[model samples]
Target: MPRILITGGCGFIGSSLASELLCLGYQVTVIDNLSRRGSELNLSRLLAMGAEFHKSDTCDPEALDKLNDSFSCLIECSAEPSVLSGAVGDGARSLLNVNLMGAVNSFEWARRRSVPVIFFSSSRVYPYDRLNACHYRETETRFEFVDGCSGVTQAGVSVSMPLDGVRSLYGASKLSAELILREYALQYGLPAIINRCGVVAGPWQMAREDQGVFTFWAARHYFRLPLQYIGFGGNGHQVRDLLHIQDLVDLVVRQVAALRDRPSDFRGDIYNAGGSIRSSLSLREATEICRRLTGHEVSTASRIEARPSDVIWYVTDNGPTGKVFGWEPKRSAEVVLQDIVAWIKDNASLLKEILV
Candidate 1:
């Protein structure tokens, strides 16, 4: 088995991937800053599972330089993932440093060693204004794309979608990183692959208002906390596709194997990894599901003011991903919700320390 290093490995997606890779007999090492809430707990879990961990910030190239570069692959998952990030105070600097500079340092390390890298990008790289301008109809529970909408279909938004408008600071940082990765791949001959992923949800996600909305909503319902349907007339019609961490790991494993075994076969450098229409969920629908799963109900208020750069609807079109990787999400929305609900229930005591 190949030894792998995962930056941000204590994060929801990164930690989940680490667990899966370890189970598959890969020698995994995780490096995380432990800055986020519940990250220490996640780190402990990874350590107990036999994953070597380095408590350091990826933004500091010096910190990353201290690590041994003996790993076969680097999974660069470190980032300030909130779209609402960088809107205030030092957030702007933090977002850029973590999402862009952190990636740069990682790429530099990989470049020096000629190591392969798997970069985890985001769907937010697509323009926010263009996505908002998409033709769509508001239904009772969610928004559906109207016929003749360019760059959109019943399946969802494709990579061909325009990248012309404001994509928020967070998105801009990730997009910038993706561009850098492309340059590195071409100029340095780095074996790099980028996956512009959608909403990734599953156990151990310390969801907050700005990021990890899926787990946040589930936790709110489980804890009987106040919930709200903000923006879009507060109808909770905004839609997004949810990708379970397990399914994401499956695709990642396959990608790593393909890159290792048949590098030439990895045609495209970028793929939109998500649930497509199969796991799409509206806020209203998600609330209902959480209610059922947790056996708890809390009144959800409505607010008319939408967040900056927030889109009304987004479902990833995984067509290109499936064609290139022969992979599709195996987990449904219900199953994803059930797993989150169960995790929250099991860790309610610990979660209250951080989530509440």
Candidate 2:
């Protein structure tokens, strides 16, 4: 059996990946720094499932060295969780250290041994500001992509879109890592794949005021915490296409399989792995769904200031990714929301850490 190592394996996406890979008969090793509450919980679940765990930060070479690198592949998932926090300048250093340098460490270590690697990238790397020219329509409660941006066949945002000046500090940091991954693949003959995912949501996300919108909303709705619509503009119609953890893992697995046979095809590149246009939803719609599902009202306060460089509607085109991995999102927003609500309602105590 081929061995695999996952950095930040205790994260929402990472944990889901670990579980899925274990079921597929691979020797899985999870490395997490345990920086977030959700991550620790994920690690606990993985440990219960008999997956090996190393409580170490990926940015630290000493911690990474502890792993038996005889492994065939590595997935870098560890990073500072909040893009907003990183945007605020206070969290810039942490973002650089964990998000950028952490990936550097993983790639460097993997390159030295000729191990193939996969990286988790965010859609924020796209020139979100340039998307302002795209059109959108507002509904009774939320917004939807207008024009050619709707339906499953709509071919969401492609990788070729210019990534010039449209990212927050968090996005910039991830973009830096993506470039480095590409460079390393070119220089060292190490096969590398960068998956640019959007709003990856499932169980085990650390819901907070600053990040993980879906999980945060679930927690607030479950515990009746204060939910606020802080000046995002429109009827709270900022739409985000969400990708389920399962679909994302499937894409990664496919990439791994393809690389195993033909490494060159998988190296030196980036792909947008997202939920496509049909899966996109707005804050207003999400709030209404939460209210209808839980029989609780979602909080909404008109914003005094609109969020910065925010796009009213943007959807990722997965054409290239589908061609590469033959993968697409399988879960509907309703199904994902149902699962999210069920998990948080069942694990109510997790909200305490979430609010903090």
Candidate 3:
């Protein structure tokens, strides 16, 4: 059995991946700061599931250097995962430290140990301004791209889209890290793979306004909390695609196996991974689904002011990813929401303290 080390393994995506890998008989070790809300709960769960836990911060190179255990692979999941992260005073500095400097530390560790790395990047690396400027028409429930749009496809925004505009500071950090990974792969022959993921949601997510929108919406509806549509004239029509955590883990397992089995065949460095156009939902559509599932009638309001880096429509095109990995998201939006609802209900006592 291979040993896997996951950074930020106490968070939602990291913990979920650790749980699945452990269940599949891999030796999983997790290192996390447990700084985020609800991370302690996730950490406890992972510990109970037999994953070794280390309370450490990735931003500190000294801390990373002190680790003694050897692992076959590293999954870089530690991030400040919010588009609005660097909009305020100290946020910019913090974002750079965690997202950029942290990657450097991970890459350095991988280089020294001669191990492969699986990086969890975000679709936010795509320029926010350019995505907001996409040509689209509004329908009854959501926005649709105009016919013959240059950068978009039936599958959604492709990997070939322009990256010249302003992606938020968070995005810039991630993109910088990606470039560094590429250089390391070329110069040092480091086996690095990047997954540019979008809107990954499921249970165990401590959802917030700027990240994890799906879980945030579901939790708000279930708790009868106020909901709002804040951008694009506040019609609740902004769109995003969803990918379940299980589906993401499935792809990661396949990629990790291939990396160990046939390293030469996994040539593609970066692949856009998400549910694509088929599993996308607008805010309005998501609201209705959440309302139906939660049986709650939460009052909602609209504000015409748009948030910084907010995109009106974003559904990732998984074509390139599927072509390379032979993997695509299997969970539908409804099924994903249903799963979240069940998880929330099952753990209402714990979630209420954090979610509400």
What's each prediction's TM-score? 0.97, 0.93, 0.97
lDDT (10s digit) by residue, model 2, range 253-337: 8987887788877666888888887788888788888887788885677674656546666567786788667777898777777
Kindly list the per-residue Cα lDDT of model 1 for residues 224-305, writing each as its tens digit. 8998899989989899999998899999998888788766543328889998798999999999999999999989999999
> Model 3, which residues run further than 4 Å from truth?
147-149, 266-268
Tell me the deviation in Å of residue 330 in model 3.
0.5
Off by over 4 Å in 2: 144-155
* True-vs-predicted CA distance for residue 155, candidate 3, Å: 1.8
Give the distance in Å from residue 349's predicted Cα in candidate 1 to where it truly belongs: 0.6
lDDT of 2 at 239: 79
lDDT of 3 by residue, 1-356 (tens): 99999999988999999999999999999999987899999998888899988888898888888776578888999989998998876889888999999988988988888778889888998988777777789999998876454567756887788789898898899899998988877788878789999999999998887789899999999899999999898999999999998889999998888788766544329888898788899999999999999999788899999988898888998866776678879999999999999999999999998876
- At residue 282, candidate 3 shows an lDDT of 95
> Model 1 Cα displacement at 202 (Å)?
0.8
Give the range of the ten consecutive residues with the poorest summed lDDT in model 2.
Answer: 146-155
Tell me model 3's lDDT, rounded to 2 decimals: 0.87
Q: Is candidate 2 or candidate 3 better by TM-score?
A: 3
